[model samples]
Target: MPTRWELDKASIYSTKAGEKDRTYLDSAFCLTDDVSTPSRHEGRQVAIGKKVLQTLLTQLAGQGSALSRERTALVVATSWSDESYFVTGVSGKTDAPAGFTPGEQVAELAAAFALGGPALSVDTACSSFPYALDMAQALVNSGQADNAIVMALNTVLPPALFLGFS
Candidate 1:
């Protein structure tokens, strides 16, 4: 029989105040809000999508997601990778003043939550979430981690990108 990996916890963050009860029945969600927390690493801004994921992850951790954080793998999926640049624009900073390593969202999240297992970001356009899920399952199945957190975020899209996708 195949080992079952049950979902212990799930959290969601949206424009509306649906974070407390992050569920499919959230009654029409939107991502156009300026919902973002300040970055810890300078010169590196956190995109809206990352911000949303961070909030959800924080909620999970706060409510005790039953994760052995250090043994948990994190995989984030999204098509907007370079959104930090657009959000940051031209900040006359010397280095990554805020957000770590520049363009490395996984690194920042891992550091924030202290996830010591394999963590990575996946960008395969529209299907990135599934790809990330596969990678997460592979990590857990391969014994690299005890469990995994798969986050898919696509929000605060710029006008041009929104048009293209539309």
Candidate 2:
């Protein structure tokens, strides 16, 4: 299946050096809620999630041909929060703590395009976005959708989450 949501362009926005002790700011919007602080995951988590959705929407909108009124596009986003406690589990019952409510964020993004389709969030271990991309292609191949948006976002950090990757 061919990708309907072509990654024609992408960008990463980082905070000024040492702003947060050199921690990865990952997204333009940073999540202020404490991911591991038990009850402080809403603010930061939502901020990061919205920032991601906003970025994707912005990119898609930039694609004059991709944005159309007659074609619907599906959006799928993945995050590593499912494996990190820093985000906690209050955001939603996903495999991740900072995971955004699928319908809420997805719809928020889809609504931006005049021809948006169903929006979904998937937490497939480390391959969430790849799986979602496959699904999106399937949608387009099977005549279910004309376009798709798939993104993988992980901005927060948990010590154990990346113990061996360095």
Candidate 3:
């Protein structure tokens, strides 16, 4: 028989709130920063995404077995990965500051938590979060990792995309 995998811990951040729990559907809401903010090195989405990851780590730390540079996997799902640079044409400029790519964000978080597992970034439009979760679950189930961190972030709206839709 296949071993049953259970969701050990999870965290969420949004325009409305942030949450963390062991069960999948916990309804408790915690006050969090507004999801929209000015475009900068530490933009709104990146800030919130970091907060969500930190919250999850804090939760795990409370349990006395914090994932410290362990072989833990990281999976991030985002519709836009540092699109601000592209929208503002900063990416084309020679003096563009280092923007937070989705993969880079994951790497930073993993490094902060001392996680050494595989890292993945997924962009599947509206279903990005679900896909990230699936990937994390697969990593854990396949014995590739004992723990996995899955994060989904959607930050600033691209003016071009907005104009196209409008």
Best by TM-score: 3
Query: What would the per-residue lDDT of candidate 2 be over residues 1-166, giving only the tens digit for each residue?
Result: 0121121212211244333222334445644544443332443433555566566667867885435435665655555442233445644666544434545545545665454565677767677877888887887888777777666655544433432232
TM-score for all models, in order of appearance: 0.61, 0.50, 0.64
Candidate 3 stretches with Cα past 4 Å from truth are 1-44, 63-65, 87-96
Worst 10 residues of 3 by lDDT: 1-10
Q: How many residue pairs clash in all the candidates, one count each?
A: 8, 8, 1
RMSD after CA superposition, every candidate? 13.6, 12.5, 13.9
**Global lDDT of each candidate:** 0.60, 0.52, 0.64
Better of 1 and 2 by TM-score: 1
Better of 1 and 3 by lDDT: 3
Clashing pairs in 3: 69-114
Runs off by more than 4 Å, candidate 1: 1-28, 31-65, 87-103
Instruction: Please rank every candidate by TM-score, starting with the best.
Output: 3, 1, 2
Order the numbered candidates by lDDT, best leading: 3, 1, 2
State how far residue 97 of model 3 sits from its true place (Å): 1.4
lDDT value, candidate 2, whole model: 0.52
Candidate 3 lDDT over residue span 16-111, tens digit each: 332221112236454345546434443445666667777888888899978844678988887887654343444355655566677776776677
